[model samples]
Target: REMLVAEIEKRLPAWEKKTHLKCNGWQTKIMQNKWGSCNPAGKLWFNLHLAHTPIRCLDYVILHELLHLKVRHHNKDYIALLDKYMPFWQEVRKELNDFVLMPMK
Candidate 1:
């Protein structure tokens, strides 16, 4: 948990610097089918499953959600922002989706 928070703190500033978007708070919790989510109010929730993925994958999820703070939908502007910030996001996303973890008991 602490490691996740530290990773988030390290990445948040750089994204905020690039996009001028700010998040007030963030936390991690178990999620069934999503990597991360963000609200317009600047709060973020990252899936605990992310800890199992590569660090780059985690960063991709973080940037993906932070961009959501700016654009509410996955439209052209959102895609453009992602392309601009993380050009390899699609690859990372594919890698994330392809990764499968065993069901927790």
Candidate 2:
């Protein structure tokens, strides 16, 4: 998860150089009912299933959370920010969140 976050962060600047958000850290674990979560304090958590998702989907998630630094809630401003950075974010989000993967037994 840390590595994935790092990779995403590394690509963030190039995505929208105007946005000044930064990522403090991220964690990925076997969360039963969440795709990801971000807090006002800047912590990020992702479901373990994301490890297998396409890179674009991962980028959408990272950008979504990073936007929280500027907009705390999922309001118009937040959605607009995401739309600006990731035009297809909503679609990618639906695809990524709805994805279900079985863990190794």
- Best model number under lDDT: 1
- Stretches of candidate 1 exceeding 4 Å from the true structure: 101-105
Which prediction has the highest TM-score against the true structure? Answer: 1
User: Scored by Cα lDDT, where does model 1 land?
Assistant: 0.86
RMSD (CA, Å), candidate 2 to true, equals 2.8
Task: Please give the lDDT score at residue 53 for candidate 2.
Answer: 86
For candidate 2, the lDDT comes to 0.73
lDDT tens digits, residue span 1-105, model 1: 778778878887887888888888888888887888997788999988787888999889888999888899999999999999999999999999997754544
Question: What is the lDDT of every predicted structure here?
Answer: 0.86, 0.73
Q: Which segments of model 2 are wrong by more than 4 Å?
A: 1-9, 12-18, 101-105
Clashing pairs in 1: none
Model 2, residue 77: distance off in Å is 0.7
TM-score of each: 0.89, 0.76
